[model samples]
Target: MLSLRGVRKSYGGTPALRPVDLDLVAGELVVLTGPSGSGKSTLLMIAGGWETPDGGEIVPRPPLPEVPVDRMSWRDLGFVPQSISLFEELTLADNLALARGGPGGAELLEALELGHLAARRPGEVSRGEQQRAAVARALVAAPSLVIADEPTSHQDHRRARLVLDLLRAAAVRGAAVLIASHDAAVVSRADREIRLDAPAVAPG
Candidate 1:
């Protein structure tokens, strides 16, 4: 559902992404595996349309087209970054409701096994619960694609598996799932894997 060809990016004089080529097909869960600073997150941002690539082209999923790196809406693509951006004051369910413009909050909460904690703020929940809440928030929107960066961070094995399973279910339902991480558990569970190198810009 997404395609990248010869994508490159640089911050200051150093590159953050090389000429990476990637494709994520519908109904597949692709894992991006790399060490810290290997441009995994940068690649996710680019693929999600959050960051603009310095070179190359990206073809978005349906309802989007091949376009210059800067012109992509990336927001239309569901994203869950390493930090769960849940609100401290808002109840988890309310936060998800806000994300979805007030639809499917309960269902997503239940699906993530978070229905009981709907009234709790992020600070009141365990790390894994918060992470699942983040996933619920993303899925509440039901976007055509999901891009997750370091999604398994700070969670126990069972919880991590739960979160990844939730993501896999999304992929099964036909949303392209792309997770960028160094976690072996996640990589092994992925339908496919892409190993990325440190950002290396091509010669101009």
Candidate 2:
């Protein structure tokens, strides 16, 4: 559904990414893995249109005529950043509801084992719980393209598995899922893996 051709990025004098190409299709789960600072997040940001690549372009496949053109673009994309970015003032359930723009927050909370914490604010919850809530929010919208950065970093094995299962379920439901992580379990469960080589530092 989406493709990045010859994407590259740099910060100041350092090259963060170099001519990376990626393709994402419905019902597939792909993992992006590499060492720290290898541009996994950069690539994702570019894919989600949050970051402008220094070179190359993100080409999205044309949508069917019945689908509104405005809804065909980034509106169908969802992102879960490395940091848990829930609304601090809202309860967990409320945050999820806002993401979903309707009911069903309760069901998602229950599925993620977060129903008990639904009434609490993000600040009141543990990082792991907050992480799960973040994941829930991302998937709550049932977007066509899901991009997650280090989604399992804060969860235990069981919770990590739960997150993976949720992501996989999203794929089964025809959302193209791309996750950036160093976690072995996450990588193992993915349908495909793309590794970014270490970024090269530009000469002084």
Candidate 3:
């Protein structure tokens, strides 16, 4: 449940995002689809407050609390980033424990068919398994807003379906799930799609 208005961003004087506006509502699965340099990831970063915008406004009206969108803790927000950041040193189960108050890690793992690999470390499992574990970790906390960047990029048809089902389940339970992806299959399953294009380069 958030809204962004006139958001803009740039790097080294070159624009990465044009002024953008969007509304994220509860219980919706929205996908951001676009070309390679379309700024979908940039917009997700800005919308989630992982990156600051040059000019714009984010007004987050979380249902239960007033936590700022950009400053939300893992408990209030679930995020599956492009890069897998699981702790390589810890077993998958322990990594889940380290989620800081998140619950239902085991169930999530089982749902993703990752239960057998729970005792393995990040480096010990396949990259796809690791990615699913990362997704499990994000959902363990039942966060109000879930933002994922190409979450299914590492899986085959079946596993990707599992991941999608899990994410859709989150939306059904009342979370706003926004995903950025180029996959047509992913786009087809979304309740809505926001297509993006390449941002204009800044003048020298």
Candidate 4:
């Protein structure tokens, strides 16, 4: 569902991703793995159309629509960013309701074990709960492609496994799932793995 060729990115003289190539297809879950500063998150951002790359190209396959990735609606591109951005003003269920119109939000909350806390706002829950909620919201819409950055960063083993299973299920249903994660549990469960490197720095 997505392809990147020779993609490069930099910020204020700092290198993020350097000449990276990646491909994501339906019915598969791909995980990006690397150390800090290796640009895993940057790659996810570029792939999601959230951050423009300085060079190279990002291509989408059929069913991904021919329009610009950024222009695609939320239902077509489910992105769970590295930083949790759940709405504090709305209850957990309501936050998911924004992406999905109906009971899907509730179903996701229940699956993530957040059903009893559906009425709680983001601020009222633990960080892990909020993180799972974010993941739930992204999956609620059942988008054609899913991009998640450090999705299981806040979870323990069991919870992390739960999240991974849901993502795998999404891929099984024919949606391409791309995730940036360093957690071994997350990487071990993916159908494929992409390793990135930190760009070399010139002497100042």
Candidate 5:
């Protein structure tokens, strides 16, 4: 389980996220949605340890005691940033392989209907294809915690459903999945939804 207690963030005295509390449990998929600048991405980044919050702490619990949650590494958490961050020099398959630590990239590609583009580099594929590839990479590692920001933004209805199904499957496999998206398709399929409001400003 991942829990955030009173998590808050600000930028140069401008509040981005207000005091917030959230819990992500294993075997569940949680969708975070709101308008632009509502701090959805900020919250996801904070959960994934990619960004620091001005206040509050994140506690992660690993299934096994041998691997302390506090000591968890990136392999313990799979994150897909809003920006599809793929290795431009490597083929899509190669990128997935790297994430998987070797082999098994083809299966994911086939599932997402990107098997035919496996040999192509990120630069060569369309943005939607690249986004799909990024998602596949995130799950290839089978991390305990999955954090994705606007994962379906570049996908169509069919592809979006495919991706959501994949995420749902990951949750069934005991991974806590947290996605930040405004798409109704994604929200409707989530086990739970967390809505964040943009920070309010005080009048001068």
Candidate 6:
């Protein structure tokens, strides 16, 4: 299971995440929900190894625990950040191959109903389609843990459901899934929910 013990983080002198604690098991989906600046994003980033906490211990689902965030090879962790990180100049297939290191791009695209857009560039697709492509890229490697930040922000109901379905499928395959989002629809579908409040500074 993925566990965080007394996690804390801050931006400059300002605090962003408190001493939050959470646990996520394989085959489960956890949703982090809270108001803006409540440190939801900070908590997810720390969990995904994208950011380091000022103090605490982070234990991955397996094969890792109490390791430094920088020392962790989080490649096994699929991530869909709040921003769509697709190559506007490259075709969808190329981007997938580059990110996933294999040929599952087309198959993932087909599953997400974006097969027709495979030959097109990210700029050529609609915002929602691009979002789906971003997700597909993350899934191509079949990561053990999937972390998405505001994944359904720009998606319509249909597309949002598709995204959630994709995450659920990943969890079914024994991947621990954690999503940080404000959308009630997304949070409601998760197997578990974690609410991160504002960061609490440590006493000297």
lDDT of 5 by residue, 1-204 (tens): 889999988888878888789999999999998888878988887887766789887786233323222222366777777778788988999888877778786888999999999999999999999999988988998988998889999999999999999999999999999999989999998999999986556448
lDDT of 1 by residue, 59-130 (tens): 852343244332222335676878777767889988777667664679778777789999999999998888
Clashes of each: 0, 0, 0, 0, 0, 2
Better of 4 and 6 by lDDT: 4
Question: Positional deviation of 105 in candidate 3, in angstroms?
Answer: 1.4
Residue-level lDDT of model 3, residues 1-204, one tens digit each, is 789998888999888888888899999999998788779999887767677789988896233323433222346777777787887888888777766453348888999999999999989999999889888887887888888889999999999999999999999999999999988888988999988767567876
Worst 10 residues of 3 by lDDT: 63-72
- TM-scores of all models? 0.86, 0.91, 0.91, 0.90, 0.91, 0.88
lDDT string, candidate 6, 60-158, tens digits:
524432434322234577778766777777888877886676566687898788998899998888888888888887788888988888999989988
- Candidate 4's residue-wise lDDT over 1-204, tens digit each? 688998888899777788899988899999998878888888877787767888998885223334333322357777777667887888898888876866557877888899999999989999999989988888888888888889999999999988888999999999999999889998889889988875546448
> Is 1 or 2 the stronger prediction by TM-score?
2
TM-score of 6: 0.88
Which pairs in model 2 have colliding backbones? none
Give the C-alpha lDDT of model 4: 0.82
State the lDDT at 148 in candidate 1. 84
Worst 10-residue stretch by lDDT in candidate 4?
A: 64-73
In model 1, the Cα lDDT at residue 178 comes to: 94
- Inter-residue clash pairs, candidate 3: none
Which residue pairs overlap in candidate 4's backbone? none
Clashing pairs in 1: none
Report the alpha-carbon TM-score of model 5 versus the true structure: 0.91
